[model samples]
Structure formats: structure tokens, C-alpha cells
Target chain A: MTERASFREYHQNIIERVATRLEESLPAQWQIPSSLREAMLYSLMAGGKRMRPLLVMAACEALDGNADAALDAACAVEMVHTYSLIHDDLPAMDNDDYRRGKLTNHKVFGEAAAILAGDALLTHAFYLVARLSQVHGVPAEQVVNITMDLAELAGPKGMVGGQAADMEGEQGLTELSQLEYIHLHKTSDLITFSLLAGGRIAGADEQKLEALRTFGQKLGLAFQIQDDILDIVGDEAKLGKKTQSDMKQEKVTYPYFIGLEASRGEVERLTAEAKSAVIEAGLADPSRLLEIADYLMNRDH
Target chain B: MTERASFREYHQNIIERVATRLEESLPAQWQIPSSLREAMLYSLMAGGKRMRPLLVMAACEALDGNADAALDAACAVEMVHTYSLIHDDLPAMDNDDYRRGKLTNHKVFGEAAAILAGDALLTHAFYLVARLSQVHGVPAEQVVNITMDLAELAGPKGMVGGQAADMEGEQGLTELSQLEYIHLHKTSDLITFSLLAGGRIAGADEQKLEALRTFGQKLGLAFQIQDDILDIVGDEAKLGKKTQSDMKQEKVTYPYFIGLEASRGEVERLTAEAKSAVIEAGLADPSRLLEIADYLMNRDH
Candidate 1:
């Protein structure tokens, strides 16, 4: 096989693994109300790039950790990501009718179910991490630490805080720094969580974990800037929603503050910084992490 | 002071402690967005009976556990309870303009802020529990257990599931069993979490934990039935809500199925059974729990 074909297969393998685990993440034996279960699964099973989960597994793999052991953490990050998307699409929030090329949770299940589903997903993500000790024999201290980090990164001062700022910015974004704050917390915090969690699962030291955090932060910002660029210049069908929806909603983005060319340059700079952080950390294997960083930088969607 | 006055003082002490902790619970050092923090604290500090946090402390005390050690768990349970109230009062949910004698969260903060505030509270609740190990020196294993229980009891198959069923039931009247299911999950699960968490914090064994579970299930159901009863006969001034509002909403309740007299009798019966379980467990001191049960039973609003 060609070198590119081999890389494609490696990436595809991780995606399939994450997808299957996520599909099976919700407990079937528990008496989950049918409609609630359906609403949660509908948006969860709806395919996205699975970017957050992929970052988790890749970070773990870079540490020469067992990717299988990191699978639950991988899925947990995605669950948080999915819940955010569901809530972000609520009528009270963005009121988007579609996500990942499919109808948004509230659009399909109505607002109440949508709200509950988002809540359930967020709650369940913590449950998965807590189970890591019992299921994967991760140390109790590590589990506690991982759980704490997940909550912090996703909680009020992190992703949710970012979301609140984003909504406030909707009225009128005053400065570039305000827009960056929204992206960092709303988008970057959880991505940072994915990498740090994977590193924790792999028993990486504090210094290595710090590296992962920096890498995740830079990469997340780059990915988000690329999203803004795509919104203005990309194809609608491939992008899964209407292009220029951000402009229509009057949402201020990176490209809005800085021109498209500057935004693209920012993505490239951030991706390079992200890869450099991982490489300097001297992980067991950094090839996959570096490759993923480059892939995120150039992705059309 | 008279015996009644002393009892009032005792309850007041616990409430004051929990209220102070909750007021300080949001990490001031963290970069929580100002408006989001205000929205969260608004609903949280809006006083209720403090029933759930009281249960956590009371149950911990019953097992000779240091109430101080259990405070974080107590605050965490109240956070979950408060978040549920915020979301339940949303425009898409109960659509209430008032809660606890003040404007509801969505009414005060707008729908988007209310939703994000609720999300922040829920996520923060887990963060608090995860900190128990660090703050109180609770064993990591116990912290893991508490975190897992908190998620399961509060997640889809528990409180959120019951909420979904309750919303579905709004479409039409349902059988008594369906109402019971909703009551058990929506009302009972988090209460059960409080007791079990307290027991775990106190280092209680499995048998005592089971006793707490049974006690919580019975007491929680009784509490909900009492709520339904109050909806009909309650004084609006004391209740801080409209009397017969359940009827206005066409909500099916225990009184709607069984007569008011029968519902009152059921509450008494359940309270007795709940106290019996705790008494049979031979806890360090069951008096507080027993008193709390009776207080819940006789509460007018």
C-alpha cells in the first residue's frame, strides 16, 4: 500500500473503534426511558468528524499507552462534545435546525426532550470516567484526578462559561479578545480535556500532561479558526449546513476580526505550535499526534 | 428554649451551614463569566427547604460521620437539585414566571442564560464531589463511588428519566403506576444519592448503605405525595406558589388517584417505614433522621 493509504487506514481504524464504543456507551440494562434514550442516541450516533475522541486516542497512543484502555475516556470526551452541540442548538440558544447534516436534537425531539438528553449525556460522561477505575483498573487516584479535570474543563469556568460568553457576544461583540475568549473556553477547553485525560489514562507525568494541554489548546484554536474560514468559503453539502450561517446570525468569528488570509495563517501557526509542543515533550511516539495536527489544520470541514 | 424551639434551632443551624457553603461553592478564583455566575447563584441561593442537603448531613450524622466532612457532598446534592429546578422552570419546560417567590431563572436571566446556568450548576456539582477526596481526605475509592452514584442517580435512568416520563404524562392522564414511576425516579433518586453519599463519606458498610437507600426511597416518595397534597390544600402565601396549580396544569397526582385522606395516610405510612429501616440498621444515632421524616410528613408547604 502507498504511504498515504497506510495513514488513512490507521486513522480509519481509530474512528471505527471510537464509533463502536460510543454506540455501546449508553447502558441498555438500565431502565432509560425509551424516548429519552432515542433522543440521546440520535444526536450521539449522528456522525461528526469525531475530532475530540480522536485527539484522546492519539494522545494516549503518543505516550505508548494502550489505546483500548483509553477508549472509555475517548468516548467520554465525545459525549461531552455531543451534549454541548445539543444544548447549543436549543431554541433558547442557537435555534439551529440541523447538526452533522441531520436534524438537531430539539428539532427532532422537541425542546424538553432535547434539554433532558443534553443533560443525560453530560451526566453519563462523568459516570464513564468514574467507571474507569473499576473497568480498566486505572488507579483510584488517577480516576479521581481525571474526573476532576473533566468537570473543571467542562464546567462553569470552562466550556459552559465560554458558551455563556458566546451568547453574550451575540448581542454585539466589542473586541477581538472577547471573541478569542469565547473560542478558547467554548471550543478549546474540552479539547484540552481530551488530551489531558488521555495522558492521565496513560499515566503520563505532570510535565507531559502539560505538554498535551498546550498542544490541545493550540490545535483546538486552529481547528475552530478553520471552521470559521470554511463557513465563509466552503461547500454547503460537504459542510453539512448552510454556509455563512455565522454571518447571518451576526456571530463574530476569527475570520470576521482578521481577514480570511490572516485567519488561515493563524491556523497554520497554531498547528505548528501544537505539533512542536508534543514533539518537545518527547512522547514515546509523536508521529500520529503530529499527523493529526496537520490534518486538522488543512481539513475543509 | 422550649423543645420545639430547640428543634427549630437545630434545623436552622444545618440550613445556615449549607447555605453558606453553597454561596461560596462557585470557585471565585476560576474565570466564571460574571453574568453566568450571577444566574447560577440566583436560583441556587433562592431558598427552599434545603431538604436534600439536610438529608445528606442528617444521614452522615446518623452514622457518626463528621458533618463537616460531608458538607461538600451536601452542597453537591443541592447543586443538582437547584439545576433541575432551573431547567424545569425553563420556558420550554414548565414555563414558570415565578419560583420560590421570585422571578424564575429564565424570566430573570433570559432563556439562554437560564439554560447555560443550569448546565453550569450540574457540571459544577460533579466538580464538587471530585474535590471531596482532595478537600476532606475522603478515600479516592469512596470519591469514585460517590461520583458514580451521583451520575447514575441523576442521569437518564434516574432523575432525568422520570422528568421525561412526567413531561410525556402531561399529554394525558396515566395510570397510578406510571405516576409512581415518575415519583420514584424524579423525586426519589437524588434523595437516595444524598443518603448513600453521606453513608459512604462516613465509611458505612454495604448493609448500612442499603438501609439508607431504602430509607431514602420511602421518604422521597412520601415527600412527593405531600407536595401533591399541598398543591390542593396549601396556602399560597406559605407555599410561595399558587394553590391548586397542579390541577391547573392538569397534572395527575396521588390525590387524583386516591382520595386526599388516603394520600395523607400513605405519607404517614411511608414515613414510618422509612424511619423503621434506619432504626433497624442500628446507626450511631437515628433520632435526627426520624425527626426529619416526621417533619417532612407534617410540613404544610
Candidate 2:
């Protein structure tokens, strides 16, 4: 099979496995109050690309860590990612009703359930990480490091910082630096974590991690720009979310502030940079990452 | 010193010690983004009653773990508690201006920073626990168990669940069950965690942990009722937060659903229950806990 098709299958398979593992790992404590449980499950179980976990698994595999051991880290990242999405959609935040082709968590579960679900997912992410960190095979300290990396990335000054800036910027933002700040933390930090974590779990050294970080940073920026382009040129029906949210919110996007053609060129440049970073990581198999990068460059959703 | 006076001293001293030590253990990455660092520092430095951290110390002491070693756990719990407060005060949430007689984090730092600060605190909580579990002197697995306890308590199924219920209930709550859920998760979970984590760190046997849990549960319930009473009966200026938040939101509280006399009576009952549970745990210095229970029964804020 071609690299692109193989990458897609690898990505899909890992995500599915992580999702399955996550459901199985949830204990009775998670089952408390059915409505709350439903909310947590709804958002997490709602299908998406599961890109974060894929990065984790792929990175781990590349570095030589057992994929099974990395499963918790993989799932944890997704859980954190899902939790952020649920909260970001809250009335106080982005306030959306649809994501990934389904009614948002709040729409189906009510605001309370949605909030509880988000909280659950966030907490569960840690629980899974802690459990995996001490699994019989992996050294406990290393697992701790991986989980800590995730906690930091998903937290303030990283993904959350980006979010707050993104929201606040909508009111009155003109500077490029502020906009860059938003995307770097908000958009790219988690993706960077995804790649680093995958490599770290698999035992990638600092040199490899640095290369992957470069790759991720470029991919994330390009991915976001493409997001901007999609909002303008892509179909909302397929996107499953409001196509015009950025415009409606008056938020800064590459296309809105920097011009569409320039944004497209940036994406192209970023993709190329990302490809180089992957190749430089010196993995025997850069085929998967190369394909994934190209697909991100070309994807509609 | 009187029993109440002594525990107050105990709570104050250890919380400060834990807080100081925790500052040193903070993730190095926090220093990267100046804006993010400033926001986190602003709220964290504001400080509070330090009730959660105290519980961790107390629990650890009770279970035979050195309170000093468990200091990080105490700090972690407090961070989680503080973060919840930050988010709880957003414009779409309670929209409060002060906490502990100071400007609330969001009010002082703006909504964006407030959100990031809260997220940072939550994320930092786990990072601290993960680090704590790996401390040089402690048994790694024991530390692991305590960290796990901390994780579940801070997470969705626990404290976050309660917050979600509170937010949803604010719009127009109809049932007492909903109020109970909110109190249990939002008001009590962390407190219970605090007490339980302290004990867990000390390697408290299941029986001892159960006793501490029972004490924390009653204490937590009483604490929420006390908050209800304070909202209705305490001076606004003294409370630091808007006294009328629950009332303005039209949500049920101990005062709203039950009369003042009943709420007062419940507080006394729960405090006594908490005292008895701690007594059952058989502290070598049971005096400290006895002091806290008395204070919980009668505190004004």
C-alpha cells in the first residue's frame, strides 16, 4: 500500500485500540451518576481523527517502547484533548453545538452533563496516566515524566493559554505577536506534546525528540492555517461544525489577517519543513509521518 | 492552647510549610511564558484557608507517613482547589470579584489569565503528585497510591462533577438531589481527598483510610452547610467573595432548601461525625483534629 493509505490505517487502528482500552480502564468510580457518566462517554466516544494518540503510539513505536505500555499515555492525551473541546464549547467559552458531525456534548447532555463530562475526561486522563506510568514493565519514573509532560502541555501557558488568548483576542486584537502567541501555545503545544510523548515513551533520545518537535511545530501551524482556509473555502456540511465560527467570533486566522494565498503558501512551506524534520529524526520508518503530514496538508476535515 | 486554637495553628503552620516547599517543586516549564507565569503566580500567591493541604498533612500524619514528605501532595490539592475557584468566578460562571478578601484571579488578571491560571493549577497539581511519588525517601508504590487518590479526587467524577452540577443548577435547579450532587462533588470531594491523601501517603491501612474518608465526608458536608449559612448570615465584606452569589443565581443551598436552624443543626451533627471518625482513626495527637472539628462547627467564613 502507498504511504498515505498505510498512515491512515495505522492512525485509525491505534486510535480505535486506545479508545477501547480507555473504556475498559474506566472503573466503577467513573460510573457514578448515569447522566454524568453518559456525558463523559459521549464526548470521549464521539469519533474524531484521534491524531494525538496516534502521535503517542507512533512516537513510542519509533523509539522502541511497547505500544501496549504507551496506550495509557496515548489515551490520556486524547482524554485531555476531548475535555478541552467540551469546555471550550461551553456558553462561557466558544459556545458551540456541533463537533465532528454530531451534537456537541452540551447539546445532548445539557450544560451540566457537558461540564461534568469535560471534568471527568480531564481527571480520567491523569488517572490513566498514573496507572500506566507504574505498569509492571515501564519504569515508574519514566511514566511519571510522560504524564507530567502531558499535564503541562494541556495546562495553562500551553494549550489553555492559547485558548484564553484566542477568546480574549476576539474583542480587540491587532498585533501579529499576540496572534502568534495564541497559535503557538493554543494550537501547537499539544501537538508538540503528542509527538514528543510518542517518542519519549518509545525511548527516543533528546536529539530525536528535538527533531520530532520541529516536525510537530510545523505540522501544527500548517494544520491551523488549513483550518482557516477550510473555514472560508471548505464545506460546513462535511466539517460538522459551524464553518463561520472564526468569522462570527471575529477571531484572528491566517486567512483573515494574512490573506488566503499567503496562508496557503505558509501551509505549503510548513508542510515541507515538517517533512524535513521527520526525515531528520532518523527513524527507519519515516513513511508514516511523511504520509500523515501530506494528508494534513491535503485533508478537507 | 485550646483544642481549636492548636489545630488552627497546626493547619496554618503546615499549610505554609507545604506551600513553600511546593513552590520549589513546581514544574520548570512554568518559567517559559512570562505571561502564563505571571498569571499563575498572581492567583497562587493570593493563598487561602489552606484547608485541603492541611488535610493531606493530617491524613499522612495519621497514617504514619511523614507530613513533611507528603507536603507536596498537600500543595497539589490546594492548587487544584484554587484553580476551581478561579474558573468558578468567570463572567459566565459566578462572576465574582474577590476571594479571601482579595481580587479574584479573573477580576485581577482578566478572563484569559484567570482561565489559564486555573488550568495551570489543575495541571500542576498532577505534576506535583507525580513528582511527589518519586521523591527520594518515600516508597514509590506508596507514593503512587496517594497520587492516584489525589488524581481521582481532583478529577471529573469528583470535584469537577460537583462544579458542573453547580453551574447547571444555577440556571434553575428543581431538585434537592441535584444540590446534593453539587455539594458532594464540588464542596466535599476535594476535602475528602485532602484528608484521604494525607493518610494514604502515610500508608494508612484500608481501615484507617476509611475512617479518614468518613471524617472528611462529614466535615465536607458540614463545610458546605457552613458556606450556605455564611451566605445568608455572614457579612459580605468579611467573606471576600460576593455573599449573594447563590441567591443571585437562584440556586438551592442549605439555607434555601432547609431553614437556617436546620442547616445550623446539620453543621453541628456533621462536625461531630467528623470528630468521631477521626477519633476512631486514633491519632496520637487527636487534639489537632478535635480542634479543627470544633472550628468547622462554628467558623464565620
Q: Which of the numbered candidates is closest to the native, going by highest DockQ?
A: 1
lDDT of 1: 0.91
**Clash pairs of candidate 2?**
A59-A198, A60-A198, A119-B156, A120-B156, B56-B198, B59-B198, B59-B199, B60-B198, B60-B199, B65-B202
DockQ for each model: 0.89, 0.42
Chain B vs. true chain B: TM-score per candidate = 0.97, 0.91
Q: Which DockQ-derived CAPRI band holds candidate 2?
A: acceptable
Q: Tens digit of lDDT per residue, candidate 1, span B17-52?
A: 999999889877988889999999999889888989
Q: lDDT by residue for model 2 over A1-301, one digit each (tens)? A: 3544556577777777977977876676552556666688788888788877777776777666688877877788888888888888776567777788788887887654665576677777777776765674565656666666776677765787678667667777788777777788777888888888778767777888888889878888888889989998888777877677778877778787789999999999999999998787788576667877898899998
Q: Where does model 1 sit among the CAPRI classes?
A: high
* True-structure RMSD for candidate 2: 4.4
What's the fnat for candidate 2, on a 0 to 1 scale? Answer: 0.54
lDDT to native, each model: 0.91, 0.75
Residue-level error in angstroms, candidate 1, position B82: 0.6
